[model samples]
Target: MNRRLPTKTIALLLAAALLTGCGAFSNDNRVDPELSLEQAKQTAMAMELELAEMIPDENVASVDQSQTGVLLSCDDKRGYQWTGGMNIVVQGDLDPAALVDAIIDRYSTQELYTAKSSPTPDGGPGAHVIGQHGAGYLVNQSPDRTAIEILSFSPCFVLPEGTSPRGNF
Candidate 1:
């Protein structure tokens, strides 16, 4: 016997599948209504700067910053995650391994921060650490090892009704 589902039923099933598969129901990307998009970007930038300061001041010659907005997932039609990165150029030698250890030590006393150094595929030192409100950073080294980047991300949030995600979508 040939059996076919009704069009309405098929549409409902498709919607359910998309919502589940696209992480619409996942709380991993928790939305904070109180966090505006601008506030999220600021949080990310400030955290990145704080993490960068973990390195010695004299060693840091200069810094550059970049920020971007990203959607949580395919299901996230309106929600956005603010990502920020600060590139630090060192005047003297800056040891990433030592810095990672220093960060771990610094955050140990802080209740909101937890830090750990991860393993890198290239056998170089890797770093991943978390701070308050799911704010975190991944330290990336330049291939030439002359500059270090503090790649940071903010918690997922939606822009308030009055705000736009950069005046573009």
Candidate 2:
């Protein structure tokens, strides 16, 4: 049997349908996974090399590498990725602090498509900071103040400890 619905009932049904179709109204949210800790570190390394290439030969006193790796990884309420990275310290005649700043500035100018910088969680002279675009990259000043540390993934998130990216994160 065919029956006509009341105006109020039909309005309610239409509103419900519109709401469901409108993700704006729905609570459903999705985010792409961030680069693993290892990936983040690698990105940072690449950035370091690229920056080194940019500087005039005479300006750079020296380039040293200490420790480089990913530190932390997590998701947040705002729907953004997060990573904590650490850099290997550097020692040289040039201003270590200035060098690090230059590296970071270049990082912001290039590489990161859309990213913001925040204080490094560990806390140190090495411009510690987190950069995020949808995903996250934990960037740390190298302990030596020469190399930058980028923790692309969380240390805790390991793949059998020894399993490599070929089969691990």
Candidate 3:
């Protein structure tokens, strides 16, 4: 039984075994398969509302929360995660620099998130806040600085076993 197999055959077999064992080609990205779909949705919604409240009521124009089961894009990852997000727009005769400072302060004070500001190199619109469980917010302004846009979103995640998705499309 000391016969040596061809190198190519051995390599192919090794590759196949590695792929099968590691799930390298598997489409599911359920890093935490124990997480339930309802739990994920609840986290996303809670974070979305918490972020929305950070803005001053006077500056809020509207808040639109995304529906449940929003598909995660990237054809390969379509069914792996869902979208939980809220979009808000602010418009008025306001000082954006001051608003930005205020927002950053709010994020910093919040126990749920650690805040940071990422301003554009040329001082354009670019800033965000990162929170627990991939929850976060982004703040951007129109080129003309007439309107400021805000978005808060939950982290895309998969549900646990024994349960199907609400809407994975």
> Residue-wise lDDT of candidate 1 within 42-80, one digit each (tens)?
887777788877778888777776645343321255566
TM-score of each: 0.69, 0.35, 0.54
RMSD of 3: 16.9
Ranking by lDDT: 1, 3, 2
Candidate 3 lDDT, tens digit per residue, 138-162?
5545444444544433443554345
The TM-score of predicted model 2 comes to 0.35
- Give candidate 2's whole-model lDDT: 0.35
Worst 10 residues of 2 by lDDT: 20-29
Clashes of 2: 23
TM-score quality measure for candidate 3? 0.54
Each prediction's total of clashing residue pairs, residues at least 3 apart in sequence or on different chains, is 0, 23, 0
Q: Judged by lDDT relative to the true structure, which candidate is superior, 2 or 3?
A: 3
Per-residue lDDT of model 2, residues 17-107, tens digit only: 2333211121222333444445544555554454445444654444542233222212233222222222233334445456556655755
* Candidate achieving the largest lDDT: 1
